[model samples]
Target: MSELTLAIDQSTQGTKILLVRQDGTIAYKITKNHQQIINPQGWISHDLTEIAANLKFLIRKALSHAGDAAIKAVTISNQRETAAAWSRRTSAPLALAIVWQDNRTTKVTEQPNIKKREKIIKYKTGLPLSPYFTASKFNWLQTYEPAVQTALSTGDLCLGTIDSWLLYLLSEGTYKTEPSNACRTQLMNIETCEWDPELCEIFGINPKNLPTIVDSDSNFGTTTLFGTLEKPIPITSILGDSQSALLAENCLHPGEIKVTFGTGSSIMMNTGQKLLRTKNGLNTSVAWKRKGKTTYALEGNVNYSGALISWLKDRLKLINDPAETDEMAQAASKNDTTFLIPAFSGMAAPYNKPELKAALVGMTPLTGRNEIVCAALDAIIYQINDIISLMCQVFTDSKLTLHVDGGMIANQYLMQRLADIVQCKVLISPIQELSGVGTSLNGMNNQTLTLSVSKTYKPCLDKIQSQNQVKIWANNIKQLTK
Candidate 1:
């Protein structure tokens, strides 16, 4: 029987299982989307029970399709900063998991107590005081949720990000998280790579409630797929989705960067071992930890990218399918002046305004569905450009390339526009599930895994035109902020 690595990617939109070959290529895959529970208060959540069940279903489904292939190992890549609380004794969720994009904690972060220590918090965590992270969500739970309060009083509360939640459920109660996920919690000290007591206290979180920090490639434990597998498989690796994409893109050296365009987006630049904190809005985080050594990174987040496309289809019903966006954008009038500021979940990174609402600006009588669809796609590119511009400033002397992988990369129009706006070559990965491939590569111990780019998009727009478009985007942002 041939050997395969079973990789599970539990993301915001869904849970996916991939049967990966030794060569870091996917052999078989299946995806199961979970419910995105949005309450009346605009708080977004996920039912942990539904996600956990979906994962088991995908595992069984993937394994049944494996035929004679023996599953040698398992790995996981999960959405970062989405916090969950559960009972350590009973293992039932205390409440719905708080999604990273949920901005309900804006009030918590703005409190006099938290605002006074914002600088100190930033110094320790290398993240700004915002509702985009896990700490404030945990604080919200502690302050308001009765179930969480009861669990904590009984010393049975287990707080963690999605990776740890999945790890704990899958691996015989292995409650641990890797650096990439841990560092985003705003509880872990980026330099020390451990949960900070001061930071935890400030967020009203107990260090004892957090997961044990482990290496990205640590032996997470063994799992039997909750009895679906004939025998247990070693769970070998765990990484945040963006960090996994970074590894999959082969961005191992300093100054190398990768952008993951998912529901939201994460633009990460590997900064080697140095924890280079930025004053210009980029957050510092642990890229990954392996062999007892830590690699640091600088990151900028966008709260809406692919989600904007989803909004077009689901909310406004502008497009029937996300795939139709490419043609719709191409059909748009070249002279159309419509622009979309996708601040639905509030602006992230560089701006850090959770209260900001989305706006569709400069629409004229000539604007129609095609123009609006085109503008929605352009919004993704513009948000990315905002981050890449800041990164260029940080690494003025270094020549940087933008290596990108995600669902949105498949849009030819989007990729080309991204290159035109960022004014750099964008290399698109051949692999669609880079996160799953990355963790699977680690599980197989394939340090020399090579990735070949399927396509490359280079700047084609005239310099003056590109500059004029960016200036217009800047003016819209300024007007919105003012």
Candidate 2:
């Protein structure tokens, strides 16, 4: 292996490629923004052409800074649930990539054919039945897109998540996805480590179109098409962005937990091997598979976080941008009873309701933008508490420190409230790019930098009052959605 290693993290928002020395030192890093769509029907999709176009420019710039560095391996970390299908002949995507946020699959997923399939699917994949998974999205593409239907009938279509598409482009023909990526499709059996025939029969997708499932640490192939580089490096590791972040955090032991606060907020706790089914909306999934043994996790996903702050800026015009919210937050306090439960795109995890609506409760005439802003921030943390309470049942000991990362973790008010409501130490990492850099690389394996606690917020609220207020907020949100 050469002293230099290249790692690319392709997420929902953008793609970042990093050049790291064998000493775990970052030589250089470059990122490129890809175009995303909130379509006419309000479905989120990624323009595959736009992403593909941006990659060339981004990679060229990243390598130019490498100078004479000898590259060893090229690993990938990607958004797990985003789906893309293409023709094997032209190797062009048939339609826009169905982003994980897209809700187009709700109709088909609830259909009789797919409805009964959820239980069976969960049994194998360790993922609940939802439009967020690839099974439903793949069905939607086939029914709506003529190009996809043609490819399916003629056997020209190849369906895969974002990682598969990237690996195909990088390898030129070697198309396979690691266990971390494959498990998200809701088609692969976690126990067998293979795509299930019965599961494919339920979704009406051909088994032939799916990518081959491999280990996370296994060598995928060579990046031959990346021609600007001096030598083609081996495609070494492919881990799901979330799982990779978990590994990068050095959460190799079971019972270790981390929360990622991004466009959405998710809390995942590492559970070694034992796949206990979640009863209170917590989803049990494969954290990562190594040496033929799979590590399981209890995941609690909350659909809205920073996006609420984004919504206030874009829809309400209360603030000019997301950055301005922090200043506004500083002026606001919890003295008012105002509560904003943002179920904008419905709620996930503990309150998995599709018809739920966003609400701003207990508002008075004296209410201002900053007050509303405070309530909104409080509501997001309250949601996290709801999931955390449910997550606590899995672990016998209630006393645990939460490791936090993501764009939203930067909000001081949100972090404080998160600690207060959960009654736990909320440790926020300085590097918000935990998802990108954490995936496929080790932060503690050979790295000198410590995953030290950047800031720790302790609980400072009355426990009873916080619990009562949270219940009231939940009830108010229930009414709004109804």
Candidate 3:
């Protein structure tokens, strides 16, 4: 019998279950999307029960195809910074999970106390004071939801990111989270890799209520998928989804980069063991911790990337399916000067203008749906280009290689545009289950895992054209901000 690993990726849009073989190849996969619960106030949330149920369904579906006997170990890569509070007694969620993109906690950062400590918070956490992290989300719950406050006061609260929630459930109440996820909570000290007491106090979070921090490759305990497995399997690996994708791309060396284009795009550059704090709005995060050693990354997050396409489909009814976007963009008139700023929730990193709203500029009589779609694609590339420029400023290493993945990579035009704007080679991996492949590889690192590239895009646009486009986009952004 062959040894196979089950990797679960719980993301904002859905839950994906992957079956990975011993040699880093994905054999089978299943994806299930849960509802995005949004209130009239525009706060985003998820039902913990629904997500947990989806995981079971996916695991059962995969086991039916691959057989339960073939699986030996389980690994996880989950959405980061989405937090929730649950009871320690019955394990029921006190409230809906506060998604990473939720802007409900925007007021939390504006408090006089929090604003005064922004510098100290950033110095320790390597993250900007924003509602997009876990700490603010947890604080929001405590202030508004009576049940959350009750649980916290009674010592029955388990407050953490989605990974910690899933870990607690999978381990039958272990209440643990790995560094990659914990670092994003804005509560962990970047250098020490431990929860900062001062940060917790500032955010009104108790250290005892948070999950115990563990290494990414540590033994997370055993599970049978709620009694689906014939015998219990060990859960050996856990990572934030973006970090897992970086690991999957095999970006272990400093200056190696990977960009995951999902609901939001996370662009990360491996900075090896040393921490390089950035003044350019890029985040310094723990890439992973293993065997008591740590590797760090400089990351820039875009709150809207692939989610823009979702908005076009669901909200604007521009297209019936996302796959049609590539064709529509290609059909757009080249002379059309339409451009879109996809700051749907808020712009993050480099341009941390959370108060600035989204804008679509340069529309004229010739503008059509296809032109708007094309502009949306261009906006995604431009947002990435902004991060690329920041990376160049911080690390002058000319050998930076970028590896790309996720659902958006299927569009060849976007890939080529990204290459042109950045003026570098963009390599796309053929691996379908990228995060799963990464976590599995990290857990089983003794084997020599090889990374193969399926496509490489080179810059075709000249310097003048690239600069002009960027200038025009910047001018439009300035107009909107004004």
Which candidate's lDDT is highest?
A: 1
Location of the lowest summed lDDT over 10 successive residues in candidate 3? 443-452
lDDT score at residue 366, model 2, on the 0-100 scale: 76
Clashes of 2: 0
lDDT values for all models: 0.90, 0.77, 0.88
Q: 399 in model 3: Cα distance from truth in Å?
A: 2.5
lDDT of 2 by residue, 1-482 (tens): 34666778887878888876665447788888776688677788998888887777778887778877767678788888888998877779999999887767888779897787677877787777888788888988999999999999998998999988988888887778877778878888877778999888888888899988887767788884468755677877778878877776666667777888776777788887777776677777788766667888778777677667777887799989777766787787557778887766667767777556666778888789999877777777888888778878877643477888887877787788888888888888866666555543632232333577789999888889778877887788667756
The residue-level lDDT of candidate 3 at 86 comes to: 93
Error at 338, model 1, angstroms: 1.4
Question: Positional deviation of 181 in candidate 1, in angstroms?
Answer: 0.2
User: Relative to the unseen true structure, what is the C-alpha lDDT of residue 278 in candidate 1, on a scale of 0 to 100?
Assistant: 83
Off by over 4 Å in 1: none
Tens digits of per-residue lDDT, candidate 1, 1-482, equal 79999999999999999999998888999999998888888789999999988988888889899999899999999999998999898788999999999999999999999999999989998999999999999999988999999999989999999999998899868889989999999899988888998998898888889989988988999999898877888999999999888888888888898989898989988878878878988888888999789988889998888888889999999989899999999999999999998887789888888899999999998899999999999988888888878877886644567899999888999999988988889999888899999988866664645878889999999878898999999999999999
Clashes of each: 0, 0, 0
- The better candidate by lDDT, 2 or 3, is 3
| lDDT ranking, high to low | 1, 3, 2
Query: Candidate 3 lDDT (Cα, whole model)?
Result: 0.88
- Lowest lDDT 10-mer window, candidate 1? 440-449
Please, what is the TM-score per model? 0.98, 0.94, 0.98
